[model samples]
Target: MKKLMMICMSLLMVIGLVACDDDTEGMKKVGIIQYAQHPALDQAHDGFIDALKDEGFEEGKNITFDDQNAQGEGSNAETIADKLVNDGNDLIYAIATPSAIAAAQKTTEIPIVISAVTNPEDSKLVKSNEKPGGNVTGVSDLTPVEDQIDLLVKLAPEVKSVAVMYTNAERNSELQYEIAKKALEAKGIKVEAATVSESNQVQQVAESLVGKVDAIYVPTDNMVSESIANVVSVTNEHNMPTIVGEIAMVEKGALATYGINYYDIGYLAGKQAAKILRGEAEPKDMPIEYSSEDKLEMGFNESTAKKLGITIPEELLKEAKIVK
Candidate 1:
């Protein structure tokens, strides 16, 4: 009878261990790989985390996150993605173009949701925004390039020649440059291309444009955005105003910017992630989203404007979020 009781107790303990294992398996794991540690990317990460929490998947509860940043290096992006895939994450959130491309290349089995990427189509990440046609979809930071150029023209009427500076190797920057070239040409504004392949080249690129153009326009190219202080220092030294692609550029002393809020775009991406998590939708089924009107913000740096001795017209100021 004692031997029979021992066998039953052992069986009960085995059953309890199996139940605990099943319970632990209920939690989903997510991996987030950001291309760089910039303000815009950081805001997106924060927004993504916040959105997940709002969706009832608290970080330590039913969800686990493996977040990593590539520190603005393309090679680092690939390494991070590979690590995430090897770790067997249920879903991957890739921020920025390089990270997205890296993650997509690493795995098609795991769903990838990208944020802050300007042109998903141009980057060949998706077939279309309506139907992504793959295991990848997310939010776009593709603020209307023409609208931003128009704002630049409006801000600097004397800007007959605009110097467009970007990293030549960046696909997103090339895409923006192509669109801006046509738009600026349509307005009879001569657009000069100042291309750089590295962050150190930005200062030389910006300095080279000093006498060649009336004003400079910096796109949201990762290289340029990451080293904007260098570009700003050069442009400011020339007393030339700059119209930037992201709001953080304005905060870094760009004269003005008509761009989408990175945080808000990330929040939108996060909402899409929630849908995927709940199994309400798949990444491939969900169309990529952009910031709505409310999420778009235009910021102007008054100090920078004053430093450049450029008076921002009252009309543009009315439309801008003045940054002190």
Candidate 2:
């Protein structure tokens, strides 16, 4: 009789644990904080949602999303993070480094996932990329600076000097700039960099580079993306060729880029988020992932090429996506 009673109690405890396991199936809230509105960031945000749906967390059914864009302001990221936490979201998806940093600062309890960040370790968002050792983990879109410089030289063989511009406040931009300098110099290309104090300063800085360099290289810097029109105006006037980090900027006015697919990285982050949401994974143990090499695309702007009076090679056009 004593043995039978003990077995019955064990069975009841198992049932309770099973019930707890299904908690994620009912309803969930996901808060997304984006750094700004740009094609790369936009693709990431959309892909993240698609991935969540693929994982069976459909919005308005099992999950709801509270999406907010910082519109290129750093301080707004922190405020948005606080708001998401106060609203009781189950998880926070921070797109871009600024938002991710803000989210990490907001709460250690809430599982924070990031996308489009460069280096989690340098940013202090995670203890280490391999172990994380904290409540934050996500995908990084680290720029392939060396490959980009090679592309620039290949596309414009006469590009003796390249002007690089980025926002000074961004650590990732500074890192890429330093990388570009060494890479370009090795290939016998002179590298000059200008610092934009803020978005408004991009134009003056860009205009300052006219006639000084043969081509310009723009990194995946948020401020430059936000006020890209200013840089575009200056470059177009000078017929300067600009090689950027992604397609959207190339489409806008830059010459070309061989860069990561932002959507793919975002989708990767969402899959990780689903694991956390379902209680199958914890932030501390999940390793940081990067976008695969095959996911990258080579793109060139035909309209900008025409405007600059430069004829793209037939072989190059066949392989690259020509954006008009």
Best by TM-score: 1
Model 2 residue 293 lDDT score: 86
User: Model 1, residue 287: displacement in angstroms?
Assistant: 1.0
Considering every candidate listed, which one attains the maximal lDDT?
A: 2
Deviating ranges (above 4 Å) for candidate 1: 1-19
Q: Tell me the whole-model lDDT of each prediction, alpha carbons only.
A: 0.88, 0.89
For residues 55-163, could you state the per-residue lDDT of candidate 2 as single tens digits?
9998877898999999878899989999999998889999999999999998999999999888888889999999999999999989787888888877778789988
TM-score of each: 0.93, 0.90
What are the per-residue Cα lDDT tens digits for candidate 1 across 174-290?
889999999999999998999999778888888888788898888888888888989889888888888888889889889888888888888888888888888898887889898
Of candidate 2, the 10-residue stretch with the lowest lDDT total is 18-27
Model 2 TM-score? Answer: 0.90
Error of 1 at 247 (Å): 0.8
